[model samples]
Target: MPAVTVSNPLALPRLPEPGLDARPRPVLAVTTAPSGVEGEGFPVRRAFAGVNQSHLDPFIMMDQMGEVDYQAGEPKGTPWHPHRGFETVTYIIDGTFVHQDSHGGGGVITDGDTQWMTAGSGLLHIETPPESLVMSGGLFHGLQLWVNLPASDKMIKPKYQDIRGGSVKLLASEDGGALVRLIAGGIGGYEGPGITHTPITMTHVSVNPGAQVTLPWRSDFNALAYSLAGSGSAGIERRPFHLGQAVVFGDGDSLTIRADEVQDSRSANFEVVLLGGQPIREPVAWYGPFVMNSHRELQQAMEDFQAGRLGTVPTS
Candidate 1:
């Protein structure tokens, strides 16, 4: 996709191999995402569906939005809606999106840009394609990830961050055969631009054919990998996976991924999104748009939203 790329990944900073003492995480599970329609009928792959919540912990859900090319007048987006007790990270890889929220946060994010919105207490928000994009539709591909906020921060004020593509920290594998786009969190002393309330790391990796990459991970954080395109294998046992699949790893200090020597013609490299976060380990009472610690709290959120305490949608 058109997220971000360099003419020579070899020129980028390299990630050193994990030390001999680093424990290699084992692949716990591999699941294929089910396709679904979302946000006014736009296509999406439910990336985290069917995975056990205990393994997901701090993460609630993820949707891989549109790797499809839209025809003129075919672009779609979400209607204004309310959310509470979590964060929404929308990363645009190949197209454009416009976001606006009642908290006075709004922006247009195009290729490789990210919009991070923390709907902590509550807020009304909407996302759509720009008028121009709707008129001359082209490729649209991206991911929207939902991160849970711990109870302590769940009711804090909402926040927003507009992270541009150029701000991402780029690095390569030790052998220079893979590109790592650090979107948020830290790795080997390099930090990404997006700020988060939870301890987490997000990276997009593209591994060349026959290449292998090993990443040093935080032992305290849970590890996950989702395939965006092409073929690859994960962990010490080399469990194979392809596009639209997600991998969960057992406890360890490192993660290993290897690209197939011969990939399908559609993709040149094995593209994956790596995510890990410190588990919240608290009760998760989640409903349509609200996530809270208890059923009573969820009821309160729904009542508050209906009463417009979340904030009113702005006038055009």
Candidate 2:
């Protein structure tokens, strides 16, 4: 529960590559209304890196949980479950989410807080609406992303990082037209507070109409942008995207996102989550919440969970 501050405030210098400025990354594909499915007990919209298209290396899946309002006393959430061989990044935007894991780690993540949990080996956990929220009835909105672990670090040890909203660095445009929240990795010269096993950048950006920002990224990493709220255009193609939509980018060392028109009246801005990471092109054997390099390893994970070796969560 320590604060993570920006260690550097200057943009990382890039080597001069021919045509780097001239070449803006192009949007490889646009996914709208990615197949919806019920996860645990809550409704979730699978954006990318799911069963159908799991090739986005280092990124396993992204789920946008209920932008829905729940009535008082309604039960809605994921019960106890086990995960291994990866990390789960939960960014809560509006409602209170209480978490408890078998490792005796848990917390309440409300507006703008992020819970980064590494189920490196194995762990059982539950994510649900806080008793207060469930009894009062209110809006709940958030995003959960799964990041893959390299084969070498698959069983390094479980860890957790609970990042508060205020602790995250917010960068504003010189013209005051855009704001970027650096959650993890580096943006320009500023860096987010969350540490990572694999190299990646997680940014939540808000852009006003007619405003645009070009973000430098590692050329070798795969990139994806998810439209969480409002609509916007991205890449050299200036592809138009809407809420619940995800845009996958092709090879490039940088990305440009522009807000063509404001979609929210209250904020008069377009919002998006940009994620990029170095690709781990190793083979994947996935089953339920477990992801391993081979099927045999996945079986071992199941066996461990069944044998009670992963630990147990408190019932109360």
lDDT score at residue 206, model 2, on the 0-100 scale: 77
- Candidate 2: pairs in clash: 10-189, 11-188, 11-189
- Candidate 2, superposed: residue stretches over 4 Å from native: 1-22, 35-40, 49-55, 264-267
Clashes of each: 0, 3
lDDT of each: 0.93, 0.79
Q: How high is the lDDT of residue 81 in model 1? A: 94
For 109-216, candidate 2 gives per-residue lDDT tens digits of 988899999999989998988778778987777889999999999998899999999888777654556677889998666789999998999988777787877777
Predicted structure 2: lDDT = 0.79
Best by TM-score: 1
Q: For model 1, what is the error of residue 23's alpha carbon versus the real structure, in angstroms, after optimal superposition? A: 0.6
